[model samples]
Target chain A: EAEVAQSPRYKITEKSQAVAFWCDPISGHATLYWYRQILGQGPELLVQFQDESVVDDSQLPKDRFSAERLKGVDSTLKIQPAELGDSAMYLCASSLPDSTGELFFGEGSRLTVL
Target chain B: AQSVTQLDSQVPVFEEAPVELRCNYSSSVSVYLFWYVQYPNQGLQLLLKYLSGSTLVKGINGFEAEFNKSQTSFHLRKPSVHISDTAEYFCAVSDPYQGGKLIFGQGTELSVKP
Candidate 1:
């Protein structure tokens, strides 16, 4: 089965440090998304990409977070000067352009800021 | 804009018992609904979805949900549950006008006791 892939399954860093998560969506998928799932809550969209272009990022905290799908196939999310509140599970998902909202997710990268 | 609400924060049930996880959505326009399951420390997995046509949608692991447009609800149900079913369930809505950006609910934790 073609699946979305994520790396650094677990990461722990002190506050004010830098952290990064990576994701590779399923081949041929035109839409990619990054979500954050805090403990005891559902995932929230942080950023979305459509063929290397950012479609939506209103929810993203641009002051500290940045994401890019350089090739439109794989993406990287970076957080500089991470805070304790930034600790969460970073999830990556993808779907075809016309999938109508069906998404396939990766195992996710869990981050913990001390 | 669209949002999802899961009425219960947690549901505890004995093994082999039937279970229902209530989900309600609010959207000014037609939207797609989905249910996703997340085991401990794992990424989300799609359970099912309601796009159009069928009011009742069957999904993996003997789970089903009914879309009540009049009530604006989509509740997930299972005839029998196992201890392995313990996990967090999330209800999400996606608006086509928003380029398929998904909005998730607060999540319901299902704890099936053995």
Candidate 2:
């Protein structure tokens, strides 16, 4: 089965440093998502993309976080000036254009801010 | 607006025992429900989903969930579980009209003891 791919399985950064996470969704998927998962909580949506266009980012902290899926295939999520509270696992998911709400997720990048 | 609530934060059960994880949602519009499982150090995997039609949906790994519209509930159940089944389960909801951005519950940690 095809799987979503992610880079930098783990990242450690200073509180004021910048960090980026990458994801490659399964081929032919038109929708992509970025999510943050705290230690004991479920994944929370940060941004969503539809064929290279942003569909929803209402919950994204635009001031410090930004995500892009330029060609609507792979995506990148960047966080500048990371804070301690920003430490978490960042997950990326994707689905087909006519998805029935089923999602395929990447392994995720674990971030830790010191 | 849509929100998901996972009633139990943790459920401890012995291997080969039945397990049930409860989930409820509140939504004013038509919605789709989903259940995802995350093993340690991994990303979320689709367990099952309820889009329409049958109230009871069977998913991979011998898991099943029943969607109750009147009660606003979608509970997951498994006849028997194993130690490998220990993981974090999450319930999520999405409004079909909102471009498929998911709202997730806190999560339920299923600890299948040997």
Report RMSD for candidate 1: 0.8
Model 2, range A1-114, lDDT digits (tens) per residue? 999999899999999899999999999999999999989998998988998999889889999998888877889999998999999999999988777678889999999999
lDDT tens digits by residue: candidate 2, B1-114 = 899999999999999999999999999998999999999999999999999999999999999999999999999999999999999999999889777778899999999999
State the weakest 10-residue window (summed lDDT) of model 1 chain B: B94-103
Q: Enumerate residue pairs that collide in model 1.
A: none
The candidate that achieves the highest TM-score relative to the unseen native structure: 1
lDDT of 1 by residue, A29-105 (tens): 99999999998999999999999999999999999999999988899999998999998999999999887788899
Q: Write the per-residue lDDT of candidate 1 for residues B1-114, one digit (tens) a residue.
A: 788999999999999999999999999999999999999988899999998998999999999999999999999999999998999999999987777778999999999998
Candidate 2 chain A: worst-modelled 10 consecutive residues by lDDT: A95-104
Q: lDDT at A72 for candidate 2?
A: 79
